[model samples]
Target chain A: MPKKEVLLEINHLKAYFPVKRKSMKEEKKVVKAVDDISLEIYRGETLGIVGESGSGKSTFGRTILKLVEPTEGEILYKGQQIQHLKGSNLQKYRNQMQMIFQDPFASLNPRMRIGAIIEEPMALQLTLTKEQRKKRVKELLQKVGLAEDAMHKYLHEFSGGQRQRIGIARALAINPEFIIADEPVSALDVSVQSQVLNLLMDLQDEFQLTYLFISHDLSVVKHISDRVAVLYLGRIVEIGTKKELYANPLHPYTQALLSAIPVVNFDEPKQAIPLQGELPSPMNPPVGCVFHTRCPFVMGKCHQVRPTMQEMNEHQRVACFLYDK
Target chain B: MEPINTQQVLLEVSNLKIQFQLKNGKQAKVVDDVSFSIHKGETVALVGESGSGKSITSLAIMRLLPIPPGEITAGTIHFNGNNLLDYKNKEMSHIRGNDISMVFQEPMTSLDPVFTIGNQLMESIRRHRKVSKKEAREKAIHLLQEVGIANADKMIAEYPHQLSGGMRQRVMIAIAMANNPQLLIADEPTTALDVTVQAQILNLMMKMKKEHRSAILFITHDMSVVAETADRVMVMYAGQIVEEAPVRELFLNPQHPYTTALLKTMPSLDTDVERLPSIPGIVPPAYALPDGCRFAPRCQFAMEQCQTLQPEVLTVNEAHKVRCHLFSGKEERAYAEEGSLT
Candidate 1:
């Protein structure tokens, strides 16, 4: 195997939102959407973040792309802290990190032609002429499995799968090193979903692009990710290689989440490990272990002292009292 | 558990055909000659991807299709041994919530925000049954508690906005089972929910359905959900029932090319594969569907006859039927390759 390069590193990243209350006199409340998370993204691998709604997985991805300003901590791009850069320095960093949103219908401007949508990013990032950009757009359309004529049509003229293809083409327009795909395939049908997933995988291989693939669907994330991370209530519960995590998940929350995914094969039916209660609000997240409220194997200590990420092995890291040494 | 009377069919839809009027004075068939029956206490899942007309078929059963634009051109929906098509609007309204109820995909939108959960549940009970406000309220709380809401007593007075997605869906299920209806139509009830929450809701639905012995028409595109909850599964494509079989049999030995493609395309949680065997093309639009098999364009085993000749439902076994030319005359065991057939 060849030596891998560290493309991006996040340390103690926190993204908080000010909560609005009815009474204006009340002290402001903050929703810690992403709280004290650290991870490393290699140059050419897909890091999947799986969680339920309001799990802060999306916030983490947005923070990585610098879409949401991090309340604290450092985001190192190629060993340079780029979290709070401004002016042309920020623009240069932004070009290297692009985002593919969840909804294709809303992500692509309906009024603009498909060609213009794909070229907009290139125009902003690259110093190419208009003619060169148009040529590159045609090449991108073909690479994502669309026809050259698709450039002239509006976004609504295409189906869900085709629209997603256009989104991929746009993401590749700037030739970024890392792409944050936030629930990219969740809005698509199952058949179309496979197509888009395959397309993303192929494009990753061809472009040697690193990805922060965020999705709530575990099956999809497992299918595409080299490493998987489980997020619960704005905290990373477990992170490991796909094989290590899927075969021997350590965190109680990870175990429950993996078992809860309904298996398709009937010969091997899964008895779901049911989790109690819904995900607690991020505005007032549970103290100590964020998942203590619903953790099946929770202890009294979990309600009082938060467990930090403990390295279990070379490839697996888990945040749980059960793994405490 | 009470022994279910399998002989008694709660709802029977035969040769159901539906079409929608296009803006250009043209009519497009959305569902054609679709037929199935649900026995008492049986859960029959109508499984298909989008544009398969599964939702439209469910809407037709509820008689909720917008007229002029949408119309049921043929077939009868027999509920409790009576043809529902014969019921007038007034009679249908009486039967809608009392004998039959529906739970939609998005519970937040399905539930009214202004009304309290208690108000909505009690209103349905009082409208269908002769009961006082006090009696209705008691029944409402009982239903909520049965659905596993911890603070049902205090939660009933709160509006739908106060509850989470999972709780809202549970309340929807509570309302659907309030009358102990003979039939329940769950149209992708868990599609909008998270995986963990989906499992919880599905477990609750199965438990309530067993206690009531109500037949369920579970409409969803997720094959995994169908495997977990359904007794029988019907695969629909291009507005037609391409295959129908017992749940285990369908997963173990899928017959139709479309069904095989679907089962193969699903990313299995138990196993990991480098790449899934995706079906080649999209489902053709309604107006431009093939003259014969709708899936022929995407079918890997498609032959010349498949493009122009319509295939009839061929019985492979007592509990399995498929609509594909390859299996039309071959022995069922000949094609069972244990996932290596493709």
Candidate 2:
């Protein structure tokens, strides 16, 4: 198979939020939401980001879409550095990289009609007449399995599944090359979640779209992602293909996270690695390794020195001293 | 393991029908003619999506629904050989938290923000059991430690906000187990926690239930939780019990189309599939339901009779029961004979 070109790349990305001190004598603190991460999103492949809450998966997606400003790092779009771009350049970057938020209800405008909600992106991204935008909105609605008459409905009129479809239509309205979907189907019910997931997959194939799918559910992540990244407090602890990650997980954190998932089959047994404690607060993460406090196989070095991502094999990478050569 | 007594029924609901009064002065049946029994020391899971009336059924058992908008229109809830519906509020209050306890989904909000963990746990102990303040405090610490809290002494003094989500849920479980109730109603107890934390909570619940020998009514949407904890599984849809069977048999051979569809839609970690087979339509609204089966619109094997006539519950086997026409009488017998031949 021919190599796929990298569509987006990140170099040493860091996003931190500084917290105010309670008093003058208290020291300032910072929440390392996304701390020093680097990876590449290849063209036409879905790269999934999985983690628990506060693992910085959503923040990382936001940083890539320029929704959240990076404290430090270089984000390149098709080999061009675009993080610090302003004005028209920034708008152009936003046009290429769209985001689908987790909550369908809050993400959509309550007062706006469905047609206007979808067409708003097109109006901002491209200079099109009202008639042209309406025409595209109707076509997009049909593509997402909704009837053309749905163009006149309000956000409140549709159910959770239908509202999610509308959210997808808005994301595709800009004709984005990269979509950072952050927990897109988490808000819907199980029966409805699959419908939305299938729709997203079909759209990805139809539009030839590359997706950075972010979710906390590993099973959902496994179904949609070609390559998967496991995040800890604020860092990518492991990255590999779905087969490599599922069949042979290198990182202990990844193993524990995957094993903890509740499989539907009764006889398909699983070995759950019960971590010692809860996830530490991002504001005061451990010095050596962020996961060492909860990691079962913690070595002395893990408490004194941080581990960096190292290549374990051809397609798998891990950030643990156990794999250090 | 000793076999549970099939004759000893802990909780039995007969033809439970719940109605909700809408704002426009109209009423709709939210839980329609649902009936099931929980055996002593058995873990039965109530599984369904949102608006399926699973939560409402659990709430009905607890008598927690708001009376203005919600009412138990018809049916009787018999718990421990007594009709809970027949009991007055005073008697009901005495039985609640003493014989039956519930653990809600969101532990963050379920706990009292102002009270310390010790204060909350002790309150339940003192309220249910006739124990002194000092004894209750000691029992509180013991319960906390029993639920796997390492620093039970200092942790009991901490407020709910200071504890993590997992710790808060453990505290909730500890409080629920303080009086050693015969029945524990856990309504999506571990849904909000992370996966690792969820595993811990589930393990802790199972261990606690085993030690106390409490029959648990585990309510959740995830089938994996059911597989891990429940002995019998009950699938609910549109305010009705669509299928009921032993956990292994239900997972291996689902009789209802809705149950099969639900199992198929869940993405498995063991297998790699391009796309999940999804049920097309959503659950019908309570106000506007189909004349026949609630899932007929989304059922792949739905027939003309399914859309027009309601099907009675048919016995698939000695333990398995289904409310679908396809599994009724001769068809089910033919399928069974075919299985025997195979």
Model 2: colliding residue pairs: none
lDDT for each residue of candidate 2 in B200-281, tens digit (9 for 90 to 100): 9999999998888889999999887898889999999999999999999999898888888888888878877788888998
| Tens-digit lDDT track of model 1 for A1-325 | 4788889989999999998887999989999999999999999999999999999999999888778999999999999999889889998998887899888899889999999999999888659999999999999999999999999999998888889889989999989989999999998878888889998998998999899999999989999999999998888999999989999999999889888888765565566789988899999999999998998788999999999998999899999999887
- Candidate DockQ scores, in order: 0.74, 0.78
A-chain TM-score of every model: 0.97, 0.98
Each candidate's B-chain TM-score, in sequence, is: 0.96, 0.95
For candidate 1, the docking band is medium
Docking class of 2: medium
Local distance difference test, per candidate?
0.90, 0.90
Each model's TM-score, in the order given? 0.98, 0.97
Best by lDDT: 2
